[model samples]
Target: MKPELENIPLVKNEEKKRFEIELNSHFAFIDYKETSQQISLIHTEAEPELAGTGAAAAVVEKSLIYIEESGKKLLPFCPYVFAYIKKNPEWKRIVDQRFEGYDKL
Candidate 1:
């Protein structure tokens, strides 16, 4: 993570069912759906300008931390989230083993 993005604030907009962060005048977010016991991360997006800015990684990290702190299982449906976890394996601890492709992680 870039030092500038290390502490980016995360906002959970329940109405939109997404977690967001503002970065360098644009927004990066992860779309999610929640059940009683888990959150399914469905997609991740960032403004084109955010490319190479580390914004995507920052928001993903923040959202993962939030899920851990909330004590809920994670269903990382988004390919981006899965790829991110592959790089940072510690996040597998919070993932719901029943996730359709858990073995791939």
Candidate 2:
């Protein structure tokens, strides 16, 4: 069964450069690097048991929302994140043009 995204609390762990969400007794997270101009999402993973439950997507979505609110362009370097944005083109608005190639990945 899919988890309720609204119930997951996404946390931005700046010191670790990742956004995390606790789920099903495990943690899902998206690693990123931020600069004044952009925030690059580099990796994303969910605990093995959380697979297929939308935990990864929940964290990624929340991270994107945070990046949007912060007004920084997004650089989706992680394959998963790139694929996510490609499917959710509305997020293209916040993506950095330099990494637009991610759409093709």
Top-scoring candidate (lDDT): 1
Residue 76, candidate 1: Cα error in Å is 0.5
Q: Write the per-residue lDDT of candidate 2 for residues 8-96, one digit (tens) a residue.
A: 77899989888999977899999998899899999999999987788888888899998999999999989888888878888889888
**TM-score winner among the candidates?**
1
Q: Residue 62: error of model 1 in Å?
A: 0.5
Residue pairs clashing in model 1 are none
lDDT of 2 at 49: 91
Report the lDDT of model 1 for residue 28: 94
The list of candidate 1 runs beyond 4 A from truth reads none
Tens digit of per-residue lDDT, candidate 1, span 4-100? 9877789999999999999867999999999889989999999999989989999999999999999999999999999999999999999999888
Q: How far is candidate 2 from the true structure (C-alpha RMSD, Å)?
A: 2.1
* Ten-residue region with minimum lDDT total, candidate 1: 1-10
